[model samples]
Target: MRAFVFPGQGSQAVGMGVAIADASAAAREVFQEVDEALGQNLSRLMADGPADELTLTQNAQPAIMANAIATLRMLEKDGGVRLAAKADYVAGHSLGEYTALCAAGTFDLPTTARLLRLRGQAMQAAVPVGEGAMAALLGVDRDRAETIAGAAVDSILAERGPPLVCTVANDNDPGQVVISGHRAAIERAVALAKEMGAKRALLLPVSAPFHCPLMIDAATAMEAALLDTDLSAPLVPLFCNVDAVAIADPGAIRVALVAQVTGIVRWRESVLAMQAAGVTQVVEFGGKVLAPMVKRTAPDLAAISIVSPAEVEAFAKTL
Candidate 1:
């Protein structure tokens, strides 16, 4: 069986949708629709980035989803590939979970884009600038990363200061994990990582500390927004990032979306679970970042990302 996957925030880059959008009207329509929904020239920001603006949480979230959906549109309209017929399941990393739901027909493109815009805004507003941070620990598993996070927070508490948030954000793969929380705690975690057997730890360039308790406000915002949004069951099951399990119910997807705001993105476990469920091939749309991670997590699965127009055509031919 084959699983269709979408990439997360870090996969975005300047000029991400240019090739595919230029290649197919379907792709262009997806971009146009998203621009209309968000009331911003997001397509222009994506195609000709001032670099920093496109990287903003609000812009990056919808832009990433737009690029992925546009790429999928190209595959469908020009390549004669339909997701429901070709894909056995769908999954994505972090914000890409909404992309998965979009692909599976749970939410329309406009709703998906607007939801992402609000999600980004909410998450950014959840913490003050420079007060929270995220760090990536290389060559360490989730357990080691968690222990380091605990120690980082404990050390801070030992100083008689009030408790600060420090927790694992993403269990990305076997050798790479991300930690998030207070800036000081994250810095402390990085300082302790090497001594704790991690090869290296470096802070990410994100504006907010995501997937930690510090994002509780963001989670509350999403819960409110999701409650009012129209949702339908997806065409296929989704391997959720927070739970690392396949679920198809719309209500469950809603709860997961809210919970994922401050929950560890168990990407490694999700990939393994997809493999265990008999997914032998994984097709990643929009960006190439997640393909390598998939391979790293599930060596037995064949994974490929279709980003460029040529890659899209090649992938469709294989279908």
Candidate 2:
């Protein structure tokens, strides 16, 4: 079986969807729709960038979604591929969840775009700048990383006051885990993790402390936005990031999405679950980032990254 996946924040680049948009009218329409929905020339920023502006949370969120959706449209219009017919399941990393839901037909493109815009804004506003920070703990398994995080929390509580909040933000793989919380605490964690045998611990250049309690405000905002929006049952099941489970019910998916704002992205577990479900091939739309992660996490699975019309055509041959 085949599983289609979308990429998250760091996958975005200047001129992301331009190739596909230029090659197919269907792809162009996706970009145009996103531009209109957001009431900005996001397409312009995406096509021509100073790089810094497009990398912001608000811009990167919807821009990445637009690129992925445009790639999907290119596969459909130019490569004669139909999502419902070609794929058995869909999934995405972090913010890419919204893009996956849209591709699976749970929500329209406009609603997805608007929802992502609000999500970005809410997440960005969740914590004050420089107060919270995230770091990647490399070459350590999840259990060890969790233990390190716990120790870091203890250290912080001993040094500061009670109510320490450091935690694992992402269990990416056996070799990579991300931790988030207070800046000083995270730095302490990085030092402690190295002592605990982690190969390296490096800070991430993110604007907010995502996937932590610090993002409770973002989660609350998402809950309100989700409640007001309409969600139809998806045509394909989604391997949710929060639960690492295949979810078909729109209501359940909505709840998971809201929780995911403050929940660790179980990307490693999600890919494992997909593998266990007999997904032999994984197709990553638009970006090449997730493909490498999939290969690293599950080397047995065949993975493809499609970013242009020619790549879409190549993928269609497999279908």
Candidate 3:
């Protein structure tokens, strides 16, 4: 079986989909649609970037999704590959979950783009700048990271009035863990993680501390937006980031979507579950970032990263 996966925030770069966009009119149409949806020339920013502006949360969210979807469109129109016929399941990491759902026919492209824009904005607004921060604890498993975060929480509580919230934001893989919370708490956790034998603890450049209880306000914002939006059952099952399971029910998906605002993104477990479910091949759309993660987590699975027109044509040959 085959699983199609979408990449998240860190995968985006300047001039992301320019090759595909220039090569195929169908790909250009995808960019055009996203431009119309957000009422901005996101395509221009994506193609020619000052790099700083494109990296902003609001712009990066939809820009990454547009690139992924545009690449998929190229595969379909130019390479004669159809997702409905070729892919058995689809999954994505973090914000990429929305991109996966869009590819699976759950939410339309415009709705997905707008929702992500709102999501990015809401998340950024949840905490004041510098008040919250996220750090990556490298070379440590989730359990160890959790323990470190707990210790940080204890220290913060002893020093301050209440227990300062700190938690594992993402269990990216066996050796890659991300922790999120207040700036002081996260720094405390980083120091503790290094003492606990973590190889490295580095701060992330993200605008918000995502996937932690500190994002409750962002969750509330997402709840309002999601309730008002139209969501249909995806054509393919989505390996949700929260549960690490394939969810197809629209209502259940909605519930998970809301919970994901502050829930741990179980990306490692999700990929393992896909492997257990007989997914021997994994195709990553638009960017190559997820392909390396899959390689580390599931070395036996055949992983392909489709970005340029040539890669799309090559992928079509297998189908």
Clash totals for all candidate models: 0, 0, 0
TM-scores, all candidates, are: 0.99, 0.98, 0.97
Q: How do the residues 1-319 of candidate 1 rate in per-residue lDDT, one tens digit apiece?
A: 9999999888778888998888999999999999999999999999999889999999999999999999999999898888999999999999999999999999999999999999999999999999999999999999999899999989999997799999999999999999999999999999999999999999999999999999999999999999999899999999999899999999999999999999999999999999999999999999887889999998889999889999998888889
User: Which one wins on lDDT?
Assistant: 1
Q: Which stretches of candidate 1 lie over 4 Å from their true place?
A: none
- Please, what's the RMSD in Å of model 3? 1.1
Tell me how far the alpha carbon of residue 37 in candidate 1 is from the true structure, in angstroms, after superposition: 0.6
Residue pairs in clash, model 3: none
Question: Which stretch of 10 consecutive residues in model 3 shows the poorest summed lDDT?
Answer: 156-165
Tens digit of per-residue lDDT, candidate 2, span 185-296: 7888988988898999999998888899999999999999999999999899999999999999989998999999989999999999999999989999989888878899
Candidate 3: where is the Cα deviation over 4 Å? Answer: none
Best by TM-score: 1
**TM-score result, candidate 2:** 0.98
